[model samples]
Target chain A: MTRVRIDLFASLDGYASTTGGTSDNPMGEDWGRLTAAYAATRTFHERVLGDTSGTGTTGIDDSYVAAHFDGIGAEIMGAAMFGLHAFPDDPDWKGWWGDRPPFGTPVYVLTHTAPRPPIPMQGGTTFHFRNTAVEDVLAEATEAAGGLDVRVGGGVSTARAFLRAGLVDHLHVMIAPILLGRGTRLWDDLRGLDLTHKVTTEVAESGTIHVTFTR
Target chain B: MTRVRIDLFASLDGYASTTGGTSDNPMGEDWGRLTAAYAATRTFHERVLGDTSGTGTTGIDDSYVAAHFDGIGAEIMGAAMFGLHAFPDDPDWKGWWGDRPPFGTPVYVLTHTAPRPPIPMQGGTTFHFRNTAVEDVLAEATEAAGGLDVRVGGGVSTARAFLRAGLVDHLHVMIAPILLGRGTRLWDDLRGLDLTHKVTTEVAESGTIHVTFTR
Candidate 1:
């Protein structure tokens, strides 16, 4: 059976990235601080940044970072995560990911906008737009997976929407050891989550607490 | 040098205990759930509850619990934590502690109520009411501690008051895995705290996170 998995990064106070960024730094310095440990991992360097130096630390954080890319058949995300808001009228927008995006699999972007023409990048990655319900989109992504697990690649709001719908089979959250002290909270409105999923916790070498919930 | 230490229990969403409690259960069910792991430790039974059944898990959670009781020279807390709100007018309210409190040293209760005659209890415990600034109270508590560590035992607001005043040298917060789905947040308004202090995060056997900020 194919599983639906998700991975998220949060600050100690459960903030996404409300450090008040400039126009250039939209996610703000808090976002960098929140994902600093993950960004420091060898897997992150090799996979996301395509840094083949293999010089980043290969500790517990890297293990999770490596596992983030393992055995994922397809990916699902929100339109906001795809940077569609920045260029809403521009159909030429190829997303924030350059010509060669890290995701090699077909990615389903959930948007209220009309389902756009499919954008197939240089890699095997093809961006599919969907304005349907999460279940409907998940069914499509599940079928597209052929058999492997479908991951809900996040932009916080998108992942939370999937989680609220109880579509996530496995959720791995890495809470970095920093406090943004903002009003935007990540864990709000998610009550009794532990009752449905088996929650486990582990501390990474970089002082990030890895909290995983598995069904 | 006398160090100031504080230990606080918060839910994964950063709520202390706002689960709609009764007069008897002031902190509500969230408090018990938040502190379940700590209470399950052998040190808790031996020290607080006086249960010497020799039963309880001895894991990462227990190590912190064990350290909580060690080197604590004096304690400071708010009047609400002392349960003074329950009996505002009654002069004979001998606190929530039955007979002997776990604190062996003098506990300074930060209150506007002018210094009540010191109520010395069993086990070298004395209750002293102080109407002064946080710095003044800490100085008095530190001096009373005789160069030992002064602990700011919390009722959330009290600990936060000390934390805001930059009087805390070591702050250890246990983030329980449960979410209350409420509005009260714990880490609000404490921005840039990680810049001045060293922060560490550790996961416990019970899925609780131990986040420490040390100066």
Candidate 2:
């Protein structure tokens, strides 16, 4: 089975973005740390943003992230990942990465309103939108990925739907050392589930703590 | 007047936790980064966790987070923060923080079946639960704070209630660098609300990105 993995950025105080989705605050010191965390991921860092020009850190940290990204076959995301162009009438908004998006495989987006025909980006990446449940999207991603892994990209809400449907296989979180007093949070009303896993912790050059869990 | 801020930790895919309230794949490698982000907040990080010896990064990239915290006099969280104890027959569970939680002031929890008496802890922390609306709790926190700010700590559904009520004044976010593929999301049905705030970003030493916004 192609395991599904998820990647995200969050605040210590537990917010993913400003309530309005604007990243223009001088008050959040945590998000910068999140960016720095991405900077450390090296491969995924460079691959997702298309800046593969440098080598990453040594030791287990880089190896882990690199291995994970290497095993992934496709990527899944939400409309929020492409910015605030979710609605149909909104202006034609692409992604923050310009015409050449970073994903090398097929990327499926979960949405309801705006529909864009499959868009092929520069880096051998194709974007597909699925208006159905996340489970269906996962099935599509799994089939498209062949035997490789599938990565679930986030905007927050999209991630939640899959979790609710219980389709995820593995989760990877990097804790930056800052707090966002507000914005979108990652964990909210979960109280009845029990998760069993092992935790490994690593410290990066930029002070990012890389912890890995396997269940 | 007390300014109450609410914070949530959500997956990039948008889960606060699994629908069952369990964190996605405890064995995954993502939360470590998120915890690292929490460690980056120099100001309240140590103090809140009862660690007074480390000097991790402090302050959010956006001024809005600090401003929100600065204006608060107290806090209001849901029974979820107290863990399974909040259940109908969980034996009066305290929060995950144990005795002497990190809060520097009084913290009020919204519940219907917990202890009617307030429990006090070290660092001037206390937990009070009452069957009332969040606004009512915020009002009580404000009065208890005596000119400080009030904060609404979250569990998901509680935070949504406040946002749906349009009582929030600011938001801050720390976009982590991991994903949960599935879990409870922060924004489930928060559509059509206008977020009229400017955002600012700051990268922290721990690789967490901090963002803040003012409404």
Give the winner by TM-score: 1
Q: Could you tell me the lDDT of residue B64 within candidate 1?
A: 92
TM-score of 1: 0.95
- In model 2, where do residues sit more than 4 Å from their true spots? A18-30, A48-61, A86-93, A114-116, A192-199, B1-215
Q: Write the per-residue lDDT of candidate 2 for residues B1-215, one digit (tens) a residue.
A: 44546655554335554433334443234445444556455544555655567565554422323443465567777776665443445555566787777676788888877457788887778888788876777677778989876677776677778877877765555545345555555655544332344444444444344444446
For candidate 1, the docking band is high
Question: Ten residues in a row with the worst lDDT in model 2 chain A?
Answer: A190-199
lDDT for each residue of candidate 2 in A1-215, tens digit (9 for 90 to 100): 68887765554434555453335543244445455656665676566655567765555446656765677789998876755553434545556656877678899977675366777788778888778777788889999999998988776777756655666666555645454445666655432212443434454555444544445
Worst 10 residues of 2 chain B by lDDT: B19-28
Give the per-residue lDDT digits (tens) of candidate 1, residues A1-215. 89999999888888864656667987776777788899998999999899998879899999998999999989999887787368877888988889998989999999887578989998789999999999999999999998999999987888888889988899998988888887356787789888898988899888888888889
Give chain B TM-scores in order.
Answer: 0.96, 0.77
